[model samples]
Target: MFFDKSHLVALGGNMPSAKGESVETLRAALDRIASSGCELLAVSRFYRTPCFPPGAGPDYVNAAARIACDAAPEAVLNLLHRVEAEFGRERVKRWGQRTLDLDLIGAGDAVLPDAATYQAWHDLAPDAQQSEAPDRLILPHPRMHERAFVLVPLADVAPEWRHPVLGRTVVEMRDALPDDALSEVVAL
Candidate 1:
């Protein structure tokens, strides 16, 4: 299989709409991928949290899942983009509200620390810098330590999941978060 190692996938946004797409619409998207031949690994508990951009918006049902597929990394990314389009996601606004958001969090040990990954970081937050300390996919992500949304549930399923860069467990990172920031989970 091209994806011999387990992959961490996350899905979010609103529930499916009759005239538009939403979180509930993600099931069909997953079904399509399954029909396409990807093997299901595990699905995390769904979480209902506030929208990432804040303001008066609908809450999002977030969850993580593991998958094994016979597609290359770039191919997998392309498929994710296609899935997002099918769900009504648009590129008009960065991190803007959407119907469904699917992200291939990690794929095996493929460390793609180049300009592209850094570009993604920049897109996430222009001020975010690529530090050298932890070092996973450029910088900022640093083994997923800085991302509570990624670490909390990731720890739930893969408690012992190690950061390819910092060498710390998910639980440790979660524990290390400032209490105020930990409260942000409710704001997700």
Candidate 2:
């Protein structure tokens, strides 16, 4: 079955880009998304978030945007990567700082790479998770539920978008997080 649904994308960055500051880079990314054929729907307020690994680099500025488009999940992901490259993003380090990070958090209720594939990566041990990267895109982002940086901003733009596998709303996922989980994500 084919579906045309709005995709949710998470935007983040810590390193300055050709656009200047990280926050400006994120804003430029949103513009890129719109220009890539997706209708820019909503953008969450920018937040100051500490680096995921703590001290990997400068604190990142994060936000989320909802976009309506007919592109398939992989195509949308490819577009995101292209935008990242346009802004000077590099893959030198895992979870390392970058000029931009555009994560395709979810696409309506469509799950890419199948359920089993998503679960395998989703269930990976934490240590292994950091060291490994999937060969293909994982829909609904395998780890979207576990990170406050992703969820907090997601709640702003798509609180009601349900996860295809977890069946939980973005707000529910964010609310389920421990207070300490979101301690470092403060509004900018």
Candidate 3:
């Protein structure tokens, strides 16, 4: 499962970087990602999303991508982190505004770590989610189901991709969010 070719990625950025605006930064990051042995397939249209934590920072430009990378989940995660770093991403804050963010949503139907670990992080309380961070990597991104910024764009590229644990499709997850939340994730 880790080596599954259908690798889903969620790309985002808020702050300006060496590449200029978020969209420009993300586009460059996508190219970097594709060149790193991962074949970039389809990419979702860019969307403008409200920054999380309210006034924590400016809004973000987000998008999702589908790729074919024959690599282990951890290796893929490391690759993503490395890409983020290349664009000046810092691990200073948990959920902090960043110059680049590349999240490995999932690899095909892989359930990282294990179902139990995934569930533990999935069920993590909202307050805890803001302050706490997992020391290890979790697959399908524990909160992908709840973030319109993530799912709305994901639906664009991998609408039919089902969550390995929740058994829900990306479109289904996106539709389940409140209308107000969905409204915040507007197409750019």
Clash number for each model: 4, 0, 0
Between candidates 1 and 2, which one is better according to lDDT? 2
Give one digit per residue, the lDDT tens place, for model 1 in 40-150: 677666666666556636777676677778877666667777877876777665556677777776666554555467446545542343222223333324336666666
lDDT for residue 144 in candidate 3, whole number 0-100: 95
Query: Which is better, 1 or 2, measured by TM-score?
Result: 2
lDDT comparison, 2 vs 3, better candidate = 3
Least well predicted 10-residue stretch by lDDT in candidate 1? 131-140
- Alpha-carbon deviation at 143 in model 3, angstroms: 0.6
Clashing pairs in 1: 14-23, 15-22, 15-23, 50-188
lDDT of 3 by residue, 1-188 (tens): 33577789999999999999999999999999888999888999999998987888999999999988877878888999999999999999988999999999988888878999999999999889989988888997999998999999999999999998999999999999999999999998
TM-score of 3: 0.97
Give one digit per residue, the lDDT tens place, for model 2 in 1-188.
57556889899999999999998899888988898789988999999998889889999999999998887889888999999999999988889989999999888887778899988988999999888998899887999999999999999998898888998999999999999878878999
What residue runs in model 3 are displaced by over 4 Å at the alpha carbon?
A: none
**lDDT of candidates 1 onward, in order:** 0.62, 0.90, 0.92
**TM-score: model 1 vs. ground truth:** 0.75
